[model samples]
Target chain A: MRSAFEWVDALPSSIALRESLNAYPTLLTTHVVSMCLFAGLIAFWDMRLVGLTLRKVPVSNIPTRLFPWALTGYGINLITGGLLLYSQPMRYYDNFYFWAKMALMAVAGFNMLWFHYATYKSVQAWDQGREIPMSARLAGVVSLVLWAGVVVTGRMMAYAGLMPEWWNNLNIGA
Target chain B: MTQSFFEWMQGLSFSAWMLEETWASPIIQCMHLLALVAFAGAVLVVDMRLLGRGLIKTSTARLARELDRWMIWSFVALFVTGAPQVLSTALKQYYSPFFWWKMQIIVIGLVFTFTIRRRVAFAEEGTLGHWPKVVGVLSIGIWTSVSVWARLIGLLS
Candidate 1:
């Protein structure tokens, strides 16, 4: 795994992206901006599922209407995030927070799949009702928590030094 | 006068603590980002409706009213978390052009969101013709600029 990352790190594109004066920040800004579109929409959808807000809007319409925009935001993040990782593979590979974010994202993905396949299959029966099923509501709560964790860990990646001495010592870069 | 104010803020005990405690700044920043997510979500809900995209079944006025609380509260959270971050490093922020630009854009965004955007959002649907769409686009652009300028504050200098 480490050798594979090293091979990618040595690539010209990765080095250029890492070394460029403007490209890195531009990518980062785009990533952050896109989050407003992606995560922002997802937050609303989750809230709706949990019966927090948007109760009047039919459950069926919410996902059908918002998923396209949310997916656009997700697509932007995937590309930018990929390039960011490509730019500094080893830096993220050694960072604990990076792995934490990846793990949270994986769990969040699984939660989405569960909601869509299992819970959402019966959404029609309760689409307009105020009372959401416990399973769907639980999925909403889990997703919200997981995504929040992803954001926290993602932000913390920059402050790796703030981690405990043991964690810092584990960093190969350190 | 502004420089003295910033200097005074930097001299405060709380500011000193924020600067001295390594965890304080990051924690506050994380709070700011979290607030950004909430606030942006609230804003997008309304703006997307205005653009004739999401929540098509619900009235735009109703959607705006429903999400208004989220927008206001989350913005307040953002402001509360953001102030300490600037206070901790007032002098450096005072010198950063990106910082000033972000502040100016934030002010513009707040004003635009409340006045023109709000009027358009809460206006009767289909009556405003293309105005809602225009306002929606402008609102998104303004808010997006706020995020961009905010990021540039740390990235540029």
Candidate 2:
């Protein structure tokens, strides 16, 4: 596993990104732009689901409306995030904050699944001008919390120095 | 001059405390982010509706009226939290080009939001012609700049 990490870290693309002064900053800023779209829309939809906002709007309409924007944002993040990892594979591989972000994302994924399979099946009945089932509300709350956790941990990876000290070879070019 | 103002702000007791406390910065950062999510989310939804791309099956006027309160509230929250955060690092941000850029865009964004976007939202549906579409597209572009530049402030600093 360590050898595979080292190999990717040593890849030419990774080396190029690491060497370029503008590459990381540009990528980081783009990642943030995606976050404003992805997480921002998700937060809005989740709030509506939880009956905190857009109370007059039907619940079923939100997913259909916001899904595309959300998907675009998510897609951009996936590309940018992959490049970011490529640039510093070992640093992320050993970072506790990265693992925490992964864990939170998994939880959010499961919550989304449960909402679709279980709660969303009956969305039409309670979709408009009605109280959302506590179960669905729970899912919404969970999604919001977990996504916020992902953002916080993602930011802390830099400031908190949550990167592992033992993850040497961060600079493959060096 | 701006230098003396920033220097005075940096000497404030509140600013000193905010700087000294390890958790204050992060907590304030969280508040700033939450406000961003709320403000941007509400704004984007309305903009999508104005652009005729949203699932909101209501009249544009009604949708705008309904969302206006939440948007205003979030904007207030953003300003309240953002002011102190900037003031806490006044000296540093005074010289940071990104900081100035972010501030300029933020003011421009506020004007666009209140003037053009608000007008189009309340305009009669079919009567709007091409101006609403222009405002809708511009709103999205301008807000994107606001969010991007706002996030870049920390990165550049």
Candidate 3:
């Protein structure tokens, strides 16, 4: 794994991105802009699932309408995020917060899958009701928490040293 | 006078604490980002609808009305979290051209959103013709610029 990261780190594109005066920041700005669109759509969708907001809109319409835009946002982030990783693979590879963010994202993905396959299968049964079933609501809560975690950890990747001694001690990379 | 005011702000105990405390800035930044997610998401939902892209079944007025609350709250959160960030480094902010540009753009973005954007969004369906699409494009452009400028403040600084 370390060697694979090392190999990517040595690529000409990575070297150029890291060395370029303007490209890195441009990439980062694009990443953040996309984040607002992606995470924002997902948050509202989750809020709807939890019966917090968008009560007037039918449940079936929410995902069908919003998912496309959300996916577009996700696609932009994936490309930018990949380039960012490409620019500095080892830095992220060694960063505890980065690993934590990846783990949180994985869990968020699984939660989405669970909601789609399990709870969402019966969405028609209660699509119009103000109160969704417990399973779907739980999925919303879990996704909200996990995505928020992802954001926090993503931000903290820049401030890894500020983490407590225990956290640093637990970081295998350290 | 403006520079002195910024200097005074930086000299405050609260500002000192915000800068001196290791975790304070990052925590506030996290809140700002979270608020950004909510705020931007709300904006996108309405703008997209106006563009005739998504949520085609729901009326634009209803979507805007439903999302207004989230938008306002998230904007408040962004302001609250953002103030400390500026205050903590108030003097630096005063010197940073990008910071000033961001503030100016934010003001423009806010006014445009509440005025022209709001009127278009709430207009009777099919009454405005291409106006909704133009407003949608303009709204997206203004808000995206605000975000871009905000990011540049840190990156350029």
Superposed by TM-score, candidate 1 places the C-alpha of residue B46 at a distance from the truth, in angstroms, of 1.0
In angstroms, the error of model 1 at B66 is 0.3
Query: Using Cα atoms with residue i matched to residue i, what is each candidate's TM-score against the true structure?
Result: 0.97, 0.91, 0.96
lDDT of candidate 3 over B1-157, digit per residue (tens): 9999999999999999997898899999999999999999899999999999878888999999999999999999999999999999898889888888888988988999899999989989999999999999988888888889888888888
**Candidate 2's residue-wise lDDT over B1-157, tens digit each?**
8899999998899998998887687767777777777777787788888778875587778778877887899889988888888779898888888888878987898898888889888988879787777887888888788777777777667
* Winning candidate number (TM-score): 1
Clashing pairs in 3: none
TM-scores for chain B, listed for all candidates: 0.96, 0.94, 0.97
Q: What is the per-residue lDDT of model 2 for residues A127-156, given as tens digits with 9 covering 90 to 100?
A: 886689999888989999999998888776
lDDT against the true structure, each candidate: 0.90, 0.82, 0.90
> What are the per-residue Cα lDDT tens digits for candidate 3 across A1-174?
888998999999899999999988899999999888889999999998888888888888978988988998889998998899999998887787888899999999999998999899998899888879999889999999999998888888888577667766766564
Count steric clashes of candidate 3: 0
TM-score for predicted model 3 compared with the true structure: 0.96
lDDT of 2 at A63: 86
Just chain B of model 3: what TM-score? 0.97
The CAPRI quality class of candidate 3 comes to high
Tens digits of per-residue lDDT, candidate 1, A17-66, equal 89999988999999999887898999989998899998898999978898
